[model samples]
Target: MFDLICLGHAALDRVYSIAAFPPEPTKLRATQAMEVGGGMAATAAVAAARLGGRVAFWGRVGDDAAGAAVRDGLVAEGIDVRGLRTCQGAVTSTSAVIVDAAGERMIVTHLGEGLDDDPAGLPWPMLAQARAVLVDVRWPAGSLALLRAARAAGVPGVLDVEMMAGAALAELLDATDHAVFSRPGLAEFAPGLPEPDGLAKARAAGAAVPGVTQGEHGYLWLDPAGRARRQPAFAVRAVDTTGAGDAFHGAYALGVARGLEVADCARQGAGAAALKCTRPGTRAGLPDGAALSAFLAERAAAV
Candidate 1:
């Protein structure tokens, strides 16, 4: 049985680092450039696999060089790609990531049409073997369908609710056991509500756990008892924040699968994300089992 199954988008990313945003109609040369495996669910899968969890990734990719790169990257990371399919005529999904020196990024994505196609034909039996399922908002139909199946199979379903329309957001949350939102997603979902209040409101809507990630400030969560807790972010020299959240989600899923308390799970996630930010690229900087254990051990010793 797999520790986690990630069902959503996967793509190849070309990241360019510049000093600042370019001026109107002006072009700026990048200070550095790199290519890596990216996409919300895909990155999280890499994170889990690197952290010692048995992981499976279910997504579609075009039968192109880019798609092959993505597949090869995931397999190299030790993620099971047996559930992944190759679309014959479709173009592979791709992303152009522009990162400023401030560790901020702006992504221009081309989610090829093939990625949105229904994933009903995927290996449901394999998916059912997962301890938990992590999904992203990028593939709404497939994500929801997988969540429903997971629910029926009594597996925990986690929804990484990034910025999406209200209707879609509501539907996604309705199917999610745990709803983890980005800062922008929380603002969009609960217009004027503050973090704690918004989290409470989100829980009232049927989510077992509702949380929002506030970059360096850390994360805030509301438990089943209506109690709220905040975990402080670990101090680190953040070189790139691209896949920080994805790392957090993957670690959090592993924690939950191990039956850790919600608060402890969030702390573990924060630690993983902080470690991820200390380097560059999405998967490039991820910590392995011994590294993560040492990091957490050092934190405990300091405490």
Candidate 2:
């Protein structure tokens, strides 16, 4: 059985290292540049694989060089990509990311054109073999399909609620078992509400666990019992913030599949994200199982 199945969004990210973002539309020199695979569920799949989860990626790309690179990168990371389809005449998703000296980044993305939105062709039978499934807002139709099926199968469905319209976010919130939102996502979903209140609203909507990932601050969530819980962020010098959130979501999903307690799962996610921030790229920065165990062990020892 697969430990986790990640669906939606896969892209080739072109990263440029610079001193800082310009105040105006002026050209600036990049200190370094590289290309790597990125995307919400895709990166999470890589992270889960690195952390020793038997993972599969289900998404679409184009029949182009960028798409090939994205596919090859995941395959190299040992994630099952049989479900990663390539669409004819479609442009693969691509992003231009500019990271500054402080490791913060600004991204401009082309979400691709001509990619299929129908979920009918997806391998539905595979859900029964998956311990859990993780999906992102980038592909709402597909995510909804998977989330509903996972719900019926009694498999945990983790939703990465990033930036999206309130209506779409609302529909997804009701379908997920674990709804983890980015700061902006929470703000959008429950506008003007405090974090706890926003999460409470999410829980009421249908998710058993409603949580938000606050970079450097930590993870806060309402557990199955409707009690609020928190997991402090692990402190580490950040080399690059890219993919850190992906690492958190991936590790958390893997933890769920392994039947870890909610708090322990949060800790696993925090440690993984912290470790990822210590390195320079996206996938290359994800911690393996051994490294994550050591990091979490050290922290526990210190505590």
Give the Cα lDDT of each candidate.
0.86, 0.92
lDDT of 1 by residue, 154-205 (tens): 8888888787644666777778888888899889889898888888877877
In order of appearance, the predictions have TM-scores of 0.95, 0.98
Best by lDDT: 2
Spell out the clash pairs found in candidate 1. none
Q: Which regions of candidate 1 are displaced past 4 Å?
A: 22-25
Candidate 2 least-lDDT 10 residues? 163-172
Candidate 2 pairs with clashing backbones: none
The total of clashing pairs for model 1 equals 0
The 10-residue segment with the lowest total lDDT in model 1? 163-172
Q: Tell me the tens digit of each residue's lDDT in model 2 across 1-303.
A: 899999999999999989988889999999999999999999999999999999999999999999999999999988888889899999999999888888898888899999988888888888889999999999898999999999999999999988863366778888999998999999988889999999999888888899999999999999777788999999998878998999999999999999999899899999999999887777778999999999999999999
